[model samples]
Target: MTEHPSLNKKQKQLEPFIRDTFNQEMSSNEGIKIADDENSLKAGDRGPTLIEDFFAREKLAHFDRERIPERVVHARGYGAHGEFELYKSLSEVTMADFLQDPAKKTPLFVRFSQVIGSRGCNETVRDVRGFSIKFYTDEGNFDLVAINIPVFFIQDAIKFPDLIHSVKSEPDNEYPQGQTAHDTFWDFMGSNPETTHMALWIMSDRAIPKSFRTMEGFGVHTFRFVNKEGISHFVKFHVKPLLGVHTLIWDEAQKLGEDADFHRRDLWTNIEMGNYPEYEFAVQIIREDQEFIFDFDILDPTKLWPEEIVPLQKIGKITLNRNVDNAFSETEQSALHPGNIVRGIDFSNDPLLQGRLFSYSDTQKARVGVNYQQIPINRPVCPVFNNQRDGASRYVIDRGKVSYHNNILADNTPSEVPVKDGGFVTYPSTVQGMKERKTAPLFKDHYSQARMFWNSMSAVEREHIIGAFGFELGSCLSSAVRQQMVNRLARVSRELAEPVAKKVGVTVPEVEESTVTRSTPAVSLMNTIFVADTLKIGVFLADGFPGHEVESILKQWKDAKLHPVIVSNNLGEVSGTGGVKLKVEQSFLTGSPLKYDGVYLVGGTGADDYFHNQARKFIGVVYTHFKPIGARKECISLLEDMDINGKPGVVIEEDAQFGRKFTEVMAKQRFWERPSYLYYV
Candidate 1:
C-alpha cells in the first residue's frame, strides 16, 4: 500500500501518546505474562512431565491464581493521576485544609470504569461509568466515589447487591459481557421502580460517553461539610468537564469496540500531546435547615438535586497533568474510601453512602492486603505517624520499642493532637433512626424525575435513549423480561416506552402519570458544555500530494490547539510537491477513524486511484455517522461530485481560509443540526 506524506509527521507526534497507554496497561494488567523461550519441563526427553521443574510450576501456579475476585460491579476500569487546585477558599463553610487554602494543590487518583463490563470488556459499552476520585489531602485521604451519571440504580445500599446481581451476566451462562439489556437487569428494573430515574439516564447517550475525558461526573449521594466552629451544611460534589459532557452515536460506539481499547488510546494520545484533560470541581451546597425545601429527598442516591434547584458553584479545577509511573503501583494500588475524610468533611444520612463507608475498607483488604494504606500509592504526602502497629504486608518502618498507647517509658509517643492543633474531629450531627429496618417515604416515588429526564431531552437525545433501550432489551432472549421492562417504562412516559415496546415485539401497557411532578431540565447533556480545543483530526493522504498546502493548513490547526494525525495506505514517508514530504503516522490496514475525533481528506493529485479508494472508504465511514469532514481543493471534487457538498458538517474548501473554517466546525463536532434522515448519504 502507498503511504501518505503527512502520516509520518503525525505518527511522530502521536508516538508518546500510544506508548504511554500500553505502558500503563502492561504494568497493571496481571493476566499478561511473557512466555519463556526455553524447552518445556519434561523428564528424559519429554517422556514425562517433571515435578522438579520450577519454571513450569511457577507458570502454572500464576495461571491458576490469575483470577482475583473481579469487582462485584464496575470490573472494567481505566485510571489517571492529577492535581486538584482550589479557585478560592470556603473557610466559612469548611475548615478542610485542601478547600481552605488556595495555595495548596491536592494530588488525586481517579478511576473511570464501566459498571457492567468484565476486566477485558470493550470501552464503548452502553453502561454507566464509575468516576471515582481519591484525593490525598493534607488532613487525610478523602474519596469522592461517584459515577458519570448523577443518579444510581437503587435508593438504599440494601438493594445494591440485588441491582448488581441482576444487571450482571446471568449466573448460569455468564452472557452479555458489557451490556445491561438482559432479562435479569430488565426484570429487576421492572420489579424495583425506584430505578426509574436512573433507567432514563442509562438508556440515554450519556451511558455511551464519546471518551472518558469528555464525560461529566457526579457524587450520587449527599454529604456534609463542617466548619471549625462545628457549623454543618449539606453538600453534593460535581465534576463538570471543561470539554463538556459529550457522547458518540450508538453506531460509532458499537464500531469502536472492534479495537475494544479505543478510549484508552484516545486519552493517552491527547494527554501526551500536552492537551491534558481538565474539569472544573463544582459543588451544590444546601444549608442543613433548607434541605427539606426540595420536593424530593436530597439523601436519595437514585435522584439528583437538579442544577436548577441548586446551581453548581465552580470552586476549582482538576487537571490530569501527569500519567501514572506504573499502573499497578500508582493507578491500581491506589485505594479510595469515602470514610477517609478531613476534619471539615463529613457524611450525610444517605443510606448507600453509610454502607459504602464500611464496604470500601473491607474490599481494599481483599484487593491490596490488610495494610493497604501502607502501599506507596495510597500513602499520604504529609507525615503519617500512628500508635497502631504492624499488620499483614506492612511496609512502613516505624521506629521505637513501645507501640501500644499510654506507655510511661515511651512517654505516650504519637499521642492524639487536639482539634485546635489541626487534628480531625468528626462533625457532630444527631442520629435518630429506629432499630427497625425501613426506607424513607420520600424515596418511594421514582418515576417523576425519570419522566422529567425523558421529557427534557431534545428529539435527537430522546431518540438515542429509545434506541439504546431497544438495543439492550433486544439482546435479551427472554420475551417476558423484555415486555415487563417496557411495561414499566410506560409509567415514566408513554412516548419513551412506546418505541421501545414496539421494537422489542411487545405491547405497550397503560400507565398513569407519576404523582411526582418536579423536573430538572438541566439533567440532559444538551445543556452541558461541549468544546473542541484538543479534538484529534486524522489526515488521510498519500505520496505526490501538495505538501506545502497541507503543511500550511496543519500549522494553522496546531496554532488553534487542534491535534492532527497523518494516516496513509502504509506507514512511511510520502514525497510531496517542491521536494517537501510528510510522514505517515498509521496505515489504513493498522488504524481506523474510530480512533480519531474527525477525518481530514487531503488526497493529493500525485496519489493513484487505489489510494483514492482507501481514502474514499475512510471518508464514507466518517460521513455516514455525521462526523466532521474536511477536504482541500484537490479533493473538493469528491465532496461535490458525490453530492455531499451541502451536508451539515461537510467542510468544502471555498476560500484559502478553509483551514480556519474547518477548525471551527471541528470545535462544534457534528452538525448535530443536520437531520438524521440524511445520515446514510
Candidate 2:
C-alpha cells in the first residue's frame, strides 16, 4: 500500500499493524495451513463433519463472535482519517501540545453519526448528528465528542436514559425504526419542559443536514482550558464547515430515506474523488470570572452562548484527507470518550458533561470489551507507560513482577511525572456547595432560547419548522400527546403553535405569549456561507445533443470544482452533434434528482417521449425541492411544460455568461424566495 502524503504520527503508528492478505495463503488462527478445508474432515465423502476439523471450528468460532455490541446512540456512523493543523499558537489559553505548535499537524479521526438510530438505520433521518473527533496528540489522545446542535434535550445527564427510551421505537411494537414522529417522543417532550429548546431545533432544518460536511459541530459543554500558568477560561469548541451549514428540505430528506447510506456514500465518494471535507476549528472562550455575568448558566448543557454575545475565534483547521481502509476495523472498532482529555484541558461542573465522562468509557468497555483502548484504532500514538494490567483481549505483555504503584520492585519504574514535567493536572477550582440533585436556577428558562431559535429562523425555515412539527405530531396516534405538545409550543410562539395545532387537529390555547423577541442571526441557516466547490450536478442528456456547448460548460464547471455527472437513459457512451461522445456515469433508473445538488438539462434531438417524460420528472422534483436547475435553450420547452420556467434558481443557457450565472445560482443552493406552494408539490 502506498503511504499517505500527509501522514502523521498516528498514521505511522498504524503502519505496522496494517496487514495485506494479497498473494498469501489462507491459514488457521495459529498460522497452520490445512488442506481439504472445504471437506471439513468428514468421516466419508458425504458424511457429517467430525470434531477433528480444527480449521473449520476456528473459522466458525471467529465468525460466530464477529459482531460486537453497537452503541446505544450514534450506532450508525461513518468516520475518516484527518489531520488538524493549528493556525496559531494557543499556549496562552491552552497548553495542549496539539494547540501549542503551529508547525505540527496532529493526526485525528472524525466520526459523524445520527443520535437516535440502530446500525442499520437510515442516515438521512431528522435527528442530532454526532461529530466526535479523537486527536492523537503527543501527550495522549484528546477526544472532542460533539453534536451538530449546540444545545441538548436535557440539562442534566441523569435524564439521558429516559430521553433515549422515549425517542426509541415504542416498547410494545418497535415500529418507526428511525424516527421521533411518535406518541412516546412527543409525550416526553411535553412532559419535560426543559427539552423545549432542543425540540425547536429538532423541528428546524438543522435536524436534516444536506451532508456531514455541511453541518456545524459544537462541543455542547463548557470546559475549562487552563494555560501554562494555571489561568483557566471556560471554553466551548466549534467546528465550522468550509462548505457551510446546509440542510435538506423535508421533501428531499424523505426521498433520501430510501437510500440508507446516503450521507455515508457522500462522504466516502467525496474523499475518494479528492474532494476532501474540511472544517474550521473555533472556540468561544469566556473568562472564569465572567461566567456568572451571563443571564444563562455557562454550565447548562441545554443552552448555548449566542455567537453574537461570544464571538468564535478560529484557531485551526481540520482536513479529512483520507478515507478509512476498513470500515469495521477503523471506523467501528474506534472508541471516543469525553474523559479522554490532554493536560491543559479539564472538565467543568456541567452535570451532563460530568456524567458523560463516566458513561462513555463504561459503555465503550461494555460494547468493545474491557481492553478496548488496546485496539489499534483506539490506541494512542505516544508511548503508554503505567502499572495497568491485562484484561480481555490484552495486546500488551507485562514481563515484570510489579504491576502496582508504590512498589520497590523494578526500582519503582514508570513513575508519575509532576505537572511541570508535562503531567496532567486538574485546575484547582474552588468549590463550596452541598451535594444536591438540583440544577442551577437559570436552567429553568428553557423556552427563552427556544423562542429565540424560533425568532431567528428565516420565513422559509419557520415554515419548514411548522411543517415538521405538524408531521411529527400528526404521526402520533394519541390526541392527548398532540394537544399537549401544541400547548408546549404555544409558550414559544403563537405563530408557530397556531398552525401546528390546526394541522394536528388540536385546539389552540390562548396563553401568554413570550416576550423574548431577540434573534441571533448566527443561529439561522439562511446566513450561512455558500460555495460551489464539490457540489454535485447531474447533467441529463440523451443523444445528438449540443455536445460542443455542453462540453465547454462542463469544463468550466470542473474548473470551479463542480462535479458534473452525466445521466441518460442507459449507462454507456452517448453520442452528440459535432462528433462529440461522452460517457454516461449514471442512468435515469440509477440516478434521482433528489440525490444531486442541482440538475442540468440538455435535450437530445433523437430523444423519445419516454426520455422527455423522464427529464420532466427530474425537473419537477428539482423544482419542488427548491434546488438549482439549469437548461439549454433547446430544453426550455421541457421546463415550460413542467410549469417551472422563469422560476427562482432556474438558469437557462441564453448567453455567453450562462455557465457563470448557473454556477453562481448553484452556489446559493436553494432559492427560498420561490413560491411556498411549489416546495411541497
Candidate 3:
C-alpha cells in the first residue's frame, strides 16, 4: 500500500478495515458475483420478489436493518481525523502516555454536535454543542467527551433526563423541534433553581456560535489525574479554538433558516479546502488539598473554576485535518465515553461524572450493539487480547478453547498484567460516607455563580442576553412560568430580572440579590483572540469593474489567509475592465449574506438595477449584523443610497491601505457598538 503524508497510526490501522469497490463488479455480501441486481429476481416486470430468491432476501434484510437507533441527544454530528501534539511533559501530574512525550503526535478523532436537536434538526439553532474527542493513545482509547458550555443544567447526572425532556419539544403538542422558546422549558427552569447558572449561559451568545471552529469546549465534570507516585490532583479539561471564540447574533442566526446545515457545511468545506481547524488543549489543575477552597463545590458540574483564579496551563494542540470518508461508518457508529480513560486518569467523586461513567457504556451497548467496540472507528490502535466472546456483529475470533480466565486448559493465557507491567490500577482513595439522596450544602448556593456570569458580561453581551430572554419568554404561553422565572432571576440580579420581566409582562418581586460582585473576564467573548485567517468574505462584482484594484485586493486578502469567493448576479465568467473576466462562484439567489463572514461591495459601472438592488439588500443585512463591510469608492453612492455609509465597520476603498484596514476590521468579527435601531430596521 502507498503511504500518505497525513496517515497516522490509527489511520493506518483503519486501512485493513476500509473496503473499496471502486473498480470491482457487483457482488453479494457472501462474495458471490451478481449479474443482475436492479430487477431483484422478480417474477415478471414490476412483480413482487419471491422468498425463495436468497439474493433478494439478503438485500432486503440488510436494507431493512441498516439503521440503528439514534442517540437520545447529540443526534446530529460531524467528525474528522486529527492528531494531538503535546506541548510539554506533565509527568508530575499524570502518568498517561499521551501526556508524557512532547514530540509524539497522538492520532485522534473528534465529533462536533448539537446537544438538543434530532438528526434532521437545523444546525444553527441556539443550543449546546458537543465536542467529543477520542484519542487513540498507546495505553488505550481515551475519550474526552466535552461540551461547548463549561457548566451543565443540573449538578447531578440523575436529573439529566429531566433536563433533556423539558428542553425538547412539548410532550402534548410536539411543537418547537429545535428550540427552547416554549412553555415546558421555562416551566422546568422555574421549578428547578439548580438550572439557573446554565440557563443564563445558554441565553448568552455562546449558544449560537458562528462556527464549530470558533467555539470553546469543556469537560464539565472535574476529573482526577494520578502521577506515577499515586498522588492525585483535580483536573478540568478545556479546548480553546486558535481562531478565537465568535458567535452569531440572534437576528443573523434566525436569517439562516434556509440553510439548515449551516454549521456542518462550514466545517466540512473548510477542512476540505485545507483550512484545518486548530485548538489548544489546556487543563486547570487543583491540588487535592485545595479542593474545598472555593465557595462552590468543586465536584459540582454546574460550577466553573474561574480562569482568573485557576489559570489554564496549555499542554497540547489538536488539529483536525481529514474529513471522514463515510459519515455513517465513522461518525455515526463511533462511540465516546468519559469513562474510557487511561491508567493515569481516574474519576472524581463528581456526582454527574460518576453517573455518566455507567450511562454512556450502557447506551452504547443498546444503540451500537454489544460488540460495538470491534467497530473500526471505535477500535483502539493497540493490540486487543481477551478471553471473552461476543454476541452480535462480532469481528474477533478467539482461537483457543478457553474463553474464561485462569483456565487450566490453555494455562491461563491472556493473563492480566500487574500495575508495574502496564496494567490499569485505579487510584486507591479512601471512601466512607452514608448513602443519601441529599446534596452538599455548597451545591444549594446556585445563584452565586449565575450572578458572577451576569456580572462578567460586557454591555453588548448583556444586551444580547436580555434580547434572548425576551424572545424565549415572550414565546411562552404560560404567565405563571414566566413570572416564576423572573422571580428566580431577581435572586441572581435585579438588573437582569427587571428588563426581562418588563419585556415578558411580568413584575419583578422584591428579593435580595446575590452579594457576589466578582466577575471572571475570561468567560466573556469580548476578551477572546481575534485573527482574520480563514474568515470567508463575499466579493460582490459585476461587469465593467476595475480589474486591477479588485485583483490586487483579492491577492492581498488571500495573502492574509482570508477566503474570498466571487458573488455576482449570475454564475459564470463576469467581465471586468480590460477584458479581465473572473469566474463567479455564487449568484445572489444562491448565496446569502448569513453565509459569509463579511461583504465587499464593488458595484460595476455596467451593472443593471437588479444587481444593484441585490447588492444593497446584501450589504443592508451585513450592516445590520454588525459585520465588517468594504466598498469601492465608486460604490460610496450605493452605500449612501442605503443610508449606511460611515458606519462603524464600513471601510471604503479611498486609499491604498483599504485592504489592510478592512482585514483588520474583519478580524474583530463583529462591531457590537453599532446603533441598536439598525438591527431592527
Clashing pairs in 2: none
Clashing pairs for predicted structure model 3, backbone only: none
What is the alpha-carbon lDDT of model 2 when measured against the actual structure?
0.91
Query: Model 2: per-residue lDDT, tens digit, 243-332?
Result: 999999888788897898999999999999999999999999999889899888999998999999999999999999888888899999
Q: What C-alpha lDDT values do all the predictions have?
A: 0.80, 0.91, 0.92
Candidate 3: worst-modelled 10 consecutive residues by lDDT: 672-681
Pick by TM-score: 1 or 3, better one: 3
Give me the candidate number with maximum lDDT: 3
TM-scores of the candidates are 0.90, 0.98, 0.98
Residue by residue across 28-101, what tens digits does model 3's lDDT show?
88988988887776778878877787788889889999898988999999899999999999999999999999
